[model samples]
Target: MRVPHIYQASSIALNTPVSLNDDAAGHIGRVLRMKVGEHVSIFNGEGGEYFSEIIEVTKKSVVVMPLRFDEHNVESELNIHLGQCVSRGDKMDFTIQKSVELGINEITPIFSQRCGVKLSGDRLEKKHQQWQKIAISAAEQSGRNYVPVVHPPVDLKQWLEQHTDEIKLTLHPRAEHSIKTITVPSAGVRFLVGPEGGFTDEEMAQTKQQEFVDIRLGPRVLRTETAALTVLSALQLQFGDLAN
Candidate 1:
């Protein structure tokens, strides 16, 4: 069986015992039914993993002794920050999950002109926190040492103004530019994906004025969530850390 890799927020050090919080404890001790002395890998999402073994497993907590520390760097050479337009219901959640698994470095939920989701105040905070959890879970599952950050929702224009990445692009179905034809950026990319209804003409024009390259995924129109992951995969395969 594959040893479980769990995400713990606590700091891990060599030859130290770390106590897991209740949620991780429940999953490891009850769901997985792992007993004391079983080996498991734990990471704090701080660029390394602690190879540990369960020393004590209880209903409330699981204590593990770190046997070794390994610096497993799984980050992509390409730093990608996805400005994903906010969508309704589970679609937005699914987008954040898949994006993290596909190796996005950071994400911002963009509330664009065509985005129909209206979130504010506490409700918006809750949604952002939930998306953050999704990113953490994906990092743990995908064997990533560092967790990608999911920033709170912001207006597309505001995010555009704050875009400081070396390579900036936006997805538009009717764009003349194809990603396959562009040169690979040496530093990082800040890409945008539109919502269900896509971006408005004014938004497109503004992005173009900002010098954001408009790129097309293909002829077939993909869903709002599908476009982000597809572009991430393509970038990773072409210029990032996917050597295989």
Candidate 2:
């Protein structure tokens, strides 16, 4: 059977006994009901994994002894920074989760004019924390050694102004340019995706002034969440790590 993988924040070394965190302990002991001597893989988001065997399981704690270490470097060659307009409800969460799985390097949630979600003060802070946790968990599940950074939401125009040097491109169904038209830069790509209603003319103009080229996926209209994932998948297949 494939051993279950769990993420731990503690440093791991061979022969060292480590106690699983409460959350992980419950998962192993109650959820999976793993028995003593069963193998489990643990990673700390440090680019390596520890192979361990369960030593003890109690109501409050689960301990394991590390037997070996396996170093894995599966990071993408292309660095993709997604400037995504936050979607409503669980769509945003799903986008963040799938983005990590698809190998996006960084994500910056944006508050565009057309964006439906709104947050302020503590609510904004709470949302950021929740999104960050999602990114971390997704990274763990996807076998990514590096955790993608989730930046706080910024207004679209401000974000464009701040990241002037990034190769910015915004998705627009009516745009003349296609993915094939753009030259793949050796450095990386920073893609902007609009919200449900898409970007306004003013927003599009601002992005254009910031030198962000307008591109289209095809003739059909894609939702805000779908647009980001589609671009990410295409980049990974065409110029990034997926093809490799």
Residue 225, candidate 2: Cα error in Å is: 1.1
Count the clashes in each prediction: 0, 0
Q: Residue-wise lDDT of candidate 1 within 142-237, one digit each (tens)? A: 888888989878898898888484688999888899988877666688899998998888999989888899999899899988899999999988
lDDT score for residue 52 of model 1: 94
- List pairs with backbone clashes in candidate 1: none
Candidate with top lDDT is 2
| Candidate 2 local lDDT, 1-244, one digit each (tens) | 8777788877888898999988788889999899899998888877878889999998889999999898877789988999999999999999999999999988999998889999989999999989988997898778777789999989887889974455778899999999878876766899999999888889888988989999999999998889999999998898888676
The most accurate candidate by TM-score is 1
lDDT at 169 for candidate 2? 89
